[model samples]
Target: MAHRYNLNVFCLPSELVDTLTPRALVGQPPPREPSPPPPTVAPLASAKGCNICLGATFADVDEQRVHFRTDWHRYNVKIRLSGGNAITESAFAQLVGGLEDSLSGSASSDDEISDESDAVNTLLSKINYTSLSDVPEDGTLKAPLTALTWFHSPPSTQIGVYRMLFPLDTPPSAYLSELKAMQATVEGGRKWAMFLVAGGHFAGAIVRVGRISDEQDEVVQTRKRKPPKSKPETEVLEHKTFHRYTTRKKQGGSQSINDNAKGAAISAGAMLRRYGEQALRDDIRNLLRDWAEDIHECERIFIRASVSNRRIFLDYEGCVISKGDGRLRTFPFPTRRPTQAELARCLQELVRAKVSHLTEEALRAQDEAYLASLPKPKPLPAQPALESVEKPKPPRLTKEEEIVREKWNRLLDMVSKGRLEPLKAFWEREGQDLGGIDALIPEWTGDRRASILQVAAQAGHDAVVQWLLFDLHADPTTPVPLAWTKDGGMESDASDAEAPPAGSRRTAYDLARSRAVRDVFRRCAADHPDWWDWFGIAHVPSALSKEKEEERDDKKKQRRKGLREKMREREAREREQERSSEVVFPVEEPPKAKKEPPSGPQKLGGSSGSTDGIAGLTPEMRAKVERERRARAAEARLR
Candidate 1:
């Protein structure tokens, strides 16, 4: 799939490619046709807040003005000046009424004062800490100038945002102005080099603009022009080369030779790739030298190449373009393999900026609409009268059920304590019908609501985990319940009701926390290759059977032993030759598969018509002669 070019996007159609990217704490774009605004709801009117009382909001300016004149406000001011929190209007009234003095004796004054201070402290703390997280006035969120302005979802990630960097400090108008100036350089016919090198295919060209649009736009950059109709000067210089075909992946799919590469072809292809890399580097270097004049006149150099492939143009052997070249810029989105036509497309794409903008309210609306489009979560299932709705406990337990629960609890404890012996004994005593093991099925626990398999795994009990997996037939695919928030939702950006949860949510396999436990799981999974959903657990299970691996190891050992013996024999031969004054002999190679003709056949030099010697030959002799002829014929075909 093509990489998303506009990630903070709501919807960035081709028509809106010029839509101005939003910047935080910056002025809005100049007025355009505004979409229908969200339902009007004026935010609460806030003033500097009463300085003495620390009041936050009021009905209007009139009420705020009246608030300062109130006796309680003045009294609160005095209380603040005395190095303590101000009293509330109600508290001030109670103190002024002298109710404390009437109820108690002279000792009441100190008690009343202490109570007022305590009440004021409690009121001020709430006001001081409380602020709407979504409102810009609170300094948490930046207010959007237009309802359609948007912030990147993952505030830190800015993978495909346009030329403007994330956390952009400049306004859109100024950014567009800069872009306009750059576009003017193109319109004025300055040369720009575009390069796309990937998967052994390299296409690059220094070119001049053909068609230019005067209107600086929201998204649309330029209209497509027919290649034949366009002038030849559009591409001042061009170079393309294709060499490496070592991979099984579609051409230009990737630069790496992974397992998908054919084993038989890999040795030869590796050589080709090594040559291709150097050839590509040499070609680029020569091309740059040849096009020095054109390169010097180049306004900007646009390159689109993978990290490994790009170095030929930038770093290798004193590249023409320095790594820190100001003109250096990468294609901000995915591109097809380097080609003349693709280079043309890249030229058009460079001028366009694609991003959709929306305010927080707009985002909320979209999220709500998206949620509303989904099927609702099913309500909880009905339970017996003995079960509690809030806690969802098990039904009234019979003696057998009570015994089972006790045994289950004991098994849990045994797993936690690494008492696998007792755990196995208990399993046997309880009978081998482990289908009802709570962790194996969807049933977490009767009362504890815990996944016993997860408990075993996280305890670093590989033996226990294996026993549960193999002996008890526990399913590693079964999902464990995750901790939920108070709102009955998971703490994630998106939630899937159809499944338990999504994104980082895992099954029993994940609970294999330690290396030992994880290795145990891997080994068991390898053993029973097709027993579970291995992909869901992110494990590419190896064959549980190790026969192939063992065979390979044995062959390697035998080859090593043979080589060592041969080396020792050679050393002894060399030593004997040094001590003895005898002539040195040539080392003999091992005998080949083909056998030499018998001396009898070579000596019998006769014509085809000389059948007299063969006439008296016995059937066994004739058969032997025929076999020798056949072997020679077969050996000739091999040659």
Candidate 2:
């Protein structure tokens, strides 16, 4: 007979690895260092299951026969190698180690195999208890599996697969550690889930790891409408997973199914409430269906805005991320292109401010109007019309005028005669009685008022004219006296004996302006310049020189000439009185008369015709007469 080897010796279940019987080999054992042959199969029935041992056994079988079928053994075997759940060969090691240690301490008993089987079952119970302690409180092992869902195959496949749902909402890190541990013990590596359909019954797996990208898409590229508050928070939930296998091959496999999806966003640990899970799934599906459409809109925004060229301008309500240098900047948004909702809010605010401002304005206007309506004033009584009153005509100077001039002349003559008191008294009595003479007097009188003033141009009397305009209410825009004069009296000598006719020389208008009337000139320029001739009065040089010289010389002559006549009268009266004194002779002595008669015979001049008259003197008489003659001659010489 040929030696026999039982290839079924390799089969073991997760619950009873420690209670299996060791079968002896029929042939000699192979050397430790012998070359290994290619793996061969035995018939399926050659290995038989033992419920008490919980292990497979095989008798020798013909060549090309495989003993592979073991239902109880396979179920335990499958779970012991799965990656995500706690059922695995590594989990069984935990069960086996403790079981072997408990068996080693027991004494041999009649039911030793039965005790061993009971001990294995008890060890399996302990592992199950510990594993249950580690399951999440969410009641689903996939709850913490992150954005990736894993899938496993039935008996046909050795490893499982993984896939990333779009818009994923689980973290990637949650499964990575657990998967790595599972991959270490499983021959073909751990598989991840892809889909869970109709609850957990029909789970599909793709043995590849899938992952969403870490980077985010631009928010402006995603939506024109305002995103909900949950948008950014939701992005953290999107993720990806990889269907990976622990394999040693010429080339390593890709790390994840979504390795090419570099910019996809994902969330972590974000879950709906238990009751809202279905709703969340529906939302996710809808979002997935609309994702491409949303993405295309974002691309359109990018194209239309030309954000890269600075042509696509995004008007944030306030600040947003800066296009330059990836920093942030702020600017006031322009009025145009405001979002409808934002524009509505702004207009509401503006209307409120404007209404407030208008209310203030109305209050101010009302206050002003009320103040203005309080009180006012009234007019006073009217005065008599002075401007319409006719000026009194200057009293006509009768012969008294001539007499007055004469008296003035005579009084001045008396002053030259040194009769100063009488001259002053005459002025007080007569000149002062002429009440308006003060007004007529010029400022520079040269001690003779009329003569010097007569030659001066009327224009020079500005002070007098101002007094007339302001005090006397005279008008200035009237013709001068000369304008009416025909006989040149207005330019005449001061010695003229007769006055010009009332209307011939000086008119009231002329007199009014001759004085420098201020208000009169102002009023004339304002209201009556057209009424008066614009041409200035012509100044006659002859009149100028003659009036000046004649006035001066005539004044002096009048003073001296009157004094000369008075002096002539006084000398004439003295001569007449002297002749009368000579005519009334006084009587001489009688003896002198007799002596004169005798001497006269002796002849006075020795002429017979005048003998008596000439002989009247004697020698003594002749001597006396000679003495008188000598004295008289001396007196005459002295005179």
Candidate 3:
């Protein structure tokens, strides 16, 4: 439907419109220009520039902010606040002076103060500082506070003040004087502090210089146990305190002061109270004099200082003296001299800084000089004279005895070589004087105690065996004489000419059975069966007998079998000859003739006197018989 529609404009309420629009747009005064961001202060001309976190420079506000927010900057800040980082004495003094100037300027100026300026003022007011020459004697500030003030100061000022306060090159005596002056200034029960700046660290002590006395015991009413009247029940004793000081930063880190400092301070103070200060000084002078004398006497001296413990160690020659903690530790000289200066240097370095210049050559020279100074050792006591001793001479053998020895050696040689003839000759020549062929050689004992028969068997000499068994008539059955069982269990005496000692032995059969002589035994058994039996072959071990029997049976069977085969071949040949003869000459039957009785004796031959007896025969019959005989011979030749 096409119909005319009326349009109505809707408007926001005046209150809503006002709330929606910002104040600046509504014609209200705009927020004042954001205060123009407070102009950034220009970096100072004398600024050493940040070496940490910010690098060499902070080029803009953003860079400066970034640097300050870094962890490196934060860690350095923490170190400064904790007093772990230190500055020179001069630097600290300068810082204090600068702070004083800043405070004065801020007070005199009419300019409004800012948060940073207020902070600077607060830090300045907290620090308690004075000139080195005009430090207050009764100042209440302690060393920790002083150290903290120094650490919190500007870096440049801290360095300058620290350098001025504790010069590194100051002598020990100067430091001591300064400490004494500081101690004198402390008031009430307050302690005096003095620090030595050495090796870039602060090491010193805090001392309560004035004397203090107190009564340790007071009068008391006893309840049950009472003191004896003689001993005095109520005692009033006054105790005096002297040389009471605590180490502030001896050495460094967590190390405490050694006992040497404590003992020296205590003893010196006590001596001063008891005998006056002059006496104490005199004792110190005397001690220093003695030390000087010792140093001069030493060939080489090592002066060492421990910065951490503020101790000194002296090593000279072979002696080691440790000076620390309130006591001096003196070690006895080492026996083995040091070969090089490195040992002393290492030892010095362990306890303190090394001050001696020593080397291997220098140490060697010093050691030589020290050794030369020592007294010469006494000569060793003369050794007692040894008594002369005479050894009994070996008895010289007689000519006869020498000859017997020679013959005996020769016999052994011949036996070993299996020379039957030579051995027999040697025996024959010495048989009478040697008592008998069976007489044992003195040297042939133990494993060598074999008889002639055994020796021959061992030599594998059949000829020697025969000679010994038959010609020499050696007792084959004789039991070998063992050295242990010889001559009725008595050791054989070589000097006894009548009867010789029997030696350790074995049997001839046992010797022959040895692999070295086995062949000889086998040959003997085969060549002389009768002799082998006579020699008691049956007495051999059953195992050996069975072996021999089996071997003999095998040989016999092989020989018989071979002979039977030869006989069969011969019969075959004979048969072949007969067959050939019959084929060559046929047998003819004689005409039947009247039987005639025998007269005297049958004629043995006919008139045909030829060996074939064909004189009475016809030519044809002779020829036939000759042919048969030739054929038989040809057959026999073929066989």
Q: Evaluate all candidate structures by whole-model CA lDDT and list the values in order.
A: 0.54, 0.32, 0.39
Q: What is the lDDT of residue 94 in candidate 2?
A: 41
**What clash count goes with each model?**
9, 53, 36
Best-fitting candidate, measured by TM-score? 1
Sort the candidates on lDDT, descending order: 1, 3, 2
Q: Estimate each model's TM-score.
A: 0.31, 0.13, 0.22
Q: Candidate 3: deviation at residue 93, Å?
A: 99
| Minimal lDDT window, size 10, model 3 | 151-160
* Cα lDDT tens digits for candidate 1, 139-169: 2333424322332422221123355221235
In model 3, how large is the Cα lDDT of residue 252?
31
Model 3 per-residue lDDT tens digits across residues 1-639: 111121000111222222221111111122222112222334567433453322335656666665454333433343344332323324333443433223433122224243345323333234311121122123211122121011111111110011122233544335333323322212222222222222222222222222222111123224335642332211112111122122233443221233434543445534333343233324323443444433333222222223432332222232233332122221212212222232332232222211123343554465455545545433222111111222355768899888877776777678768886677677777778766756655763333554666666655677777676556655545555444232224346533534433422335655563553544444444544555442453233322244676897899999999999999999999999887865334433333454557666665654322343444677777778777767777887999
User: lDDT: which candidate is best?
Assistant: 1
lDDT-wise, the better of 1 and 3 is 1
| lDDT of candidate 2 over 529-562, digit per residue (tens) | 4433312321111112345557867989999999
Q: Of the pair 2 and 3, which is ahead by lDDT?
A: 3
In model 1, the clashing pairs are 17-219, 18-218, 18-219, 19-218, 148-358, 149-358, 150-358, 526-544, 527-544
